[model samples]
Target: MLQGMRLTADKEHIAVVLNRPKYAGNIGSAARCAKNMGVERLMVVSDRDYPQEEIRQMSTHLAADVVDSIVYCRDLGEALSGFHYVVGTTARLGLARGPVMSPRDMAEQVVELSRKNDVALLFGPEDTGLTNEDLRYCQSVVSIPTSERFRSLNLSHAVMILCYEISMAEIGVPERFTPKMASSRETEGMYGHIGALLQEIGFLNPENPEYWMMHIRRLFSRMRLSAREVRIIRGICRQLSWYLHHRG
Candidate 1:
C-alpha cells in the first residue's frame, strides 16, 4: 500500500556534510532540514566549538535525534573518507570548481548513485563557501541558481534545497543495480600514485604538479572508477615505476 514511499532507503546511503560551519544555530537548522527530507546521516567538518544548548534549541525536538547523532571531523577529507561518491556545493565557481551541475540534475544522478554507493553531499561555510583546495576530494559539484541581483544563499537554505530535491526526485524507484564506486580512501591513494608517477615521467610540471593533476582528477572523475578499476590503475603505476627503476 505504501509503494509510493519514494525511496526512503536512499536516505541511509546518503550523508549531508557541512564543511567548517561557523554557526551552531545553522548547523542545527541544517540537521532539521536533513531530517525533514529523510536524510539521516549528518556530519560536520569543523574545529570550532559551538554551544550544544543553542544547537539543540535550533534543532528543536523533531530533529533532536539528528543533532545528537552528528559526526564531527577535523576536515572535509576526513569527513568524507568513507563515502564512495562526493558532491560539493558552491556559490562561487570557476575553473577550480570543475564542471557544475544543477541541484535538480545532481539529485537525479544521486538517486541512482546512492543506490549503489555511499554518497556525500558537501556544503561549505556560511561566508566564503568551499575553497578550490577543499574541492580536490569532490568528484563533481552542484551550484544552486539564484536571482542574478543577489546570488548568495543562506547555509541552511542551501541544505534544505539540496535535501528537498533529493527527496522529491521523480526517478526514485529502483530500476537496476548500479555498480559501486571506489571509496575515497581507495581513490585518493590511486590519485597519489598517479600524481607521483606523472611527476617522475615529467608529464606533470614538477614546480606546480597540482595544476596539472587537477585536470587529471576531472578526467578520471568522469570515468567513475570502481574499486577494481582503482586497483588496476595503481597496479599500472607500480609496474611503470618498476620499469623506470630497472630499465636504468
Candidate 2:
C-alpha cells in the first residue's frame, strides 16, 4: 500500500462477479482476495447452490463477510444488469473479444469510474474463460498477459491480480467529473432496439443480427455511453423507425 495514498474507489460499489464458477474453493479464494483488496461485494451467477462450508473454509474469517453477503444470481443479465460498467476477464482473444486492456491500465480507468459508478469485475468458469455471449454484456475486456506456453490463469489468481492493481492504484484528485454511465440493463435495451432497427433497414442480416451486432457493440462500448447518450441513440432509432414506417 502506498503511504498517504487515499483509496479512491468506493469498496461498496465494486463487485467481483463469478460467472458459472465450478469450484467452491475458487469462489472462496475469490472472496478472500476481494476482501483483502477492500472490495466487499461478491456475486455468483449459477443455479446450483455451492457448499457453504467449503466456501467459508477457503475464505476463512478474513473474508467471512464477503461470503456471507454473497448475492446468488440466476444468469448473466441478472448478475450484471445493475452495474454501470462491467469488465470481463478473458485469457483467450480474437476479433470477437473486442479491444482488450491490461489489468493495470483497466485498474486505472476503473478507479475513476468507481468513484461515481457501479463496476463489476466478471470472471468466468475455471474450465473455460468467458464466452462471446458473456463478453457481449461487458463494456470492456481485460486479458492478463501470460507466456505463450500457458495463456490461462487460475480463476482466483486472476481476481487477486485485478483487485490488487485496483486497490494499489494511486491517484491525485481528478480534474474531470466522472458521470454515471448507463447500466447494463439500460445498455442492453438500447442494443436490442438498435438491432431491430438495423435489421429493419437491411443493414444487418436478419438471420444473423448478432454477428454484425458484435462489431456494433465494440463501437459503442468504447464510448462509455451514459444513460442520456443511450436514450439519445435509442430516440434516434425510434424516429428512424417512424420515418421508415411512414415512407411511401
Candidate 3:
C-alpha cells in the first residue's frame, strides 16, 4: 500500500531528538507530527521531569506507536550518537552561526544526507532553543524562513512543517514507479522476507528470536522503507538466498 507506506514509520530515516521539551502535550503533538511524516524514532533528552504517560495518552491513536517507541536519554550528546549528521532547528541567529535557510532548502540537504547516513533533526526546548553546548553537536543549523518580525513556532508545528518539506522532496522521483498502496498482506510478506534474511545472516538469533526481532524492527522501522523499495530489497534477498543455496 503506497499510502500505508507513507503513513508508517518505515518511510523515513530521520529521527526527532527533543532537548528538554517541557509539556507533555507538546511531546504528544511532536509524536503526531513524527507519525505523519513517517519518522520512527523519537529521542527525548531532558534532565527535567517529562510526563511520559501524559504524552502517551495525548498522542491518541494516531501517535500511539511513536509515543510508545520513544527513547529517553540523559543528555543531548548521548541521544545524538550514531547519527552521521545532525541539524539543529532554531529561530534565532547567533553571532557565531551562519545564515539560515528555508525549510525547503534544509529538507533538500536532509534528503541527500539520508541517502548516506542516519540523520537527527534536533529541536530544543519550547522556551529555549539549543544551548551553546547543544549547538556544538550539530553539523549545521536550520532556521525555517519566517517573517523577520515573528518567527517562533510551536514545537509540534515546527516538526510538522519540517516533515512536510521532507515529504515534498520525495513526492516525485521519475526513476521509481510509485505503486498503489500495498495491502497489509503484501506488507507482511515483505517483512517476512526481510526477517528470514536477517535470521540467515545471524542478525535475528534463532535462540532468542523474539528479542532479535524487536531489535531488527527498531532498525528497519527507522528506515521507513517504501513499498517499491521493499520489493527491491526482497528481490535482492531472494537473489542472495539463491546464490547461497546453489554455491554448495
Candidate 4:
C-alpha cells in the first residue's frame, strides 16, 4: 500500500461521489471500479438502501477494500463540502447547466485544477439522474460522449470510466508490479454472518441448503468484505432480526 502511494508521488488527487444512487448493484460495481482505478475516496449520498450482497459480489475481490472504505452522506451538499472544484456528470444538457465536456476533457480539467486545488467528481442516481438543483453545486459538467439517442450509462460504468481516467493521469509512470488484492481474512467472517442472516430472513432460497450456499457464495464472492465492515453490516442485520422477532 505504502509503495503504491510512493509510486505516484502524489501528483493527482480525486474524490468520486455518488449522489442518491437507486440501486445496490451500481454502488457495489462503482466501488469495484473506483478501486480498480486507484481512486482512494468514495462518498455516497442517498436515502435508499445499499445492495451489499450484490455490490460485494460484483466488485469481486479487487474492489473489496473500497466497499469497506465507503462514506455515506444524506445530502449532496455534505458530500461536496470542503472541495475547491466540483464536476458533475450528466447525460442531458439543461439550459442552466454549464458546457458539457467529454470525459477526457473533464479529466484534463481535473488535472489542471488539481494542480491548483482539490477536486471532486459527482455522479447522480440511476432513475431520475441529476436534477437542475444538483448541477448548481458544480463548477463544470462532464458528459460521456455516447450516441445522442443513448447517452445514458450505468452509474458504476460511469464511475469506472472516470476513475480510470483520473488514475491513469495521476500515475503517469508505469507500475513495475500490480497492486495487491485485499486479503481473504478481510471479509470472510462477514460473508458467513450475512449468509446466516439471509437464511434467517428468507432472502436466500433454494431446495437444498448446499445449493443455496453455492448461490450465496457466487453472489457474495464479489464483495471482498472487510472485518470491520462485516461486523457493522452484521450488526444491522442482527438488530433488524431482533426488532422483527419482537415486533407485535
Candidate 5:
C-alpha cells in the first residue's frame, strides 16, 4: 500500500481536469495519479453519472481524498473558468488546433507559468479527445510521444505521464523579478471587450467572427500576457469605445 502521500498547499493551484470521461476506473486511476503527484484538485466535466464504487476501487488508497473532493462541472469552460493557464492533452493535431508541444516541454512551461497563475491540465474523454470547441478555451495543447504503431494512450496512463513530468520538473529561482500574469477570467474579459470593439469597427464579420478571433486568441495565448499587459489592452478597448461614441 502506498503510504504518506499527501496533498500540499502549492499543489492545490494545479488542477487536473477530465472532460467528459466515459469510465469510472479511468477517473479513479487519474485521481490516484493526481495524488501521487501531489495535485489535490480534480475537476470533471461530465453530464452523465459515473460508477462510484468502481472508481474508488481503482483509485485505491492513493487518491481516495482527491476522488472524494472532485469538482463536477457542466462543461469544459466551467471547469477551466478559474485557471490562468490551461493546457489541453490530445492525440490528434490539425491546422485549426493551436501549437502542440511534447509532454516534457509542456511540463517545463507549465512549471514556470504556475509560479504566478493557477494552471490546469485538461484531458478529454476515453474515446474522442477534446472537441474543437473545447480546444478554443485552451491556450496550449500537449501530446505524449508514443510508438506510431499504437499512438493512443489510456486516460490514466496519460495523466500519470503528465503528472510525473510535472512532478519531476525542477523549478529554479529567477534572478530577476517578474509581474503576475492575468488569470483566465481576466484574459477572457479582455477578449470579450476586443470582440465587441471589432464588431463596432466592422472588423469582425458577424457571420464568421471565429475566423479572426481564433487567430487572435492563438496570438495572445502565445504571448502569455501579464496582468499589466491585459489592463493596458482593456484600457485601449475603453479608449476605442469612447472614440466610437464621440464620433457618432
Candidate 6:
C-alpha cells in the first residue's frame, strides 16, 4: 500500500515566488514542488500570458489544486509586496550584490521566520538570474552550492532543492528577539523618497542617477531596516527636501 503524505500547518506561512518566468511548464513544476514540500502558496511575477493547458498538464494531479491559488503580478515589487521577509535565489555574486548565503543556511533562517511572518523564496527567470534591479527588493540571496565546472540549475530543480531542504530541516521556535521588519512595499517607497531627495540635492546626477542609486540600494539592503527604522530614514529625507526648498 502507498503511504499517505503528512502535511504541516506551518507551511502555510511560506510562499514560492517566480520572477519573470518564461515557461509555463516551469511554473507548473515549481507549483508541484511547493505542494510536495507543504508550501501552500505560489506567486508568479510575469507580464506574459501563460498557457493554462500546458501548465495544468505539467502540474499533473500533484499540484492541480494549487494552480487556482497562484497569484500573478506584472512585476517583482508587486509580487513581493506585504511579505515580511524576502529571500532571493541567485547563481552568481558580485561586489554590488548583498550578502549571499548557502541554501542550507538560508533554510535555517527561513524555517524560523515562517513561524510568525509571511516569508518568500524568490526564483529568477531561466535564461538569466535576477538582475541588480530585480534583486534590490530582496533582503538576502541564497546560492545553491554546485561544482565549479557548471553553476546553472534548471528553475524547477533549484526550487526543489530549496523546498526539500526546508522540509527536512528541524527547527525549534526560539524567543522572539527580532522586531517586525519593513515590508517590501514600505522599503521600496523609502528608496523612492531617498532617490528623489538625492536628485534634489544634486548628489545623483539627473543624467546618471541609476549608477549611484544602485550602490545606495546595496548599502540599505544590507542594513535590513525594520519598519520603524525605514520611517525614520524617510523622515530625514523629508526634512532634507524641506531644507533645500526654504534655504536663504
TM-score of 4: 0.61
> Candidate 1 overall Cα lDDT vs. reference?
0.89
User: TM-scores, in order shown?
Assistant: 0.94, 0.94, 0.62, 0.61, 0.89, 0.87
Top-down TM-score ranking: 2, 1, 5, 6, 3, 4
| Tens digit per residue, CA lDDT, model 1, 1-248 | 24444653377999999999898999999999899999978999988888998899888899999988999988777788799989999988788778899999998888878878999999988999988888889998999999999997999899999999988885645655579999998999999999989988989988888998899899998888999999999999999999998995
Off by over 4 Å in 4: 1-12, 170-248
lDDT of 2 at 201: 88
Q: What is the lDDT of residue 61 in candidate 6?
A: 82
- Which 10-residue window of candidate 6 scores lowest in summed lDDT? 1-10
lDDT of 6 at 62: 73
Candidate 4's residue-wise lDDT over 150-234, tens digit each?
A: 7768888888888767655543333443222222333344456666777787877645444455445434433433345556876
User: Candidate 6 — what's its lDDT?
Assistant: 0.83
The Cα error of candidate 1 at residue 217, in Å, is: 0.9
Model 5 alpha-carbon miss at residue 4, Å? 30
TM-score pick, better of 4 and 6? 6
The best candidate by lDDT is 2
Task: Give me candidate 6's TM-score against the actual structure.
Answer: 0.87
Cα lDDT, model 3, residue 40: 71
Colliding residue pairs in candidate 3: 1-181, 1-182, 2-181, 2-182, 10-224, 10-225, 11-224, 12-224
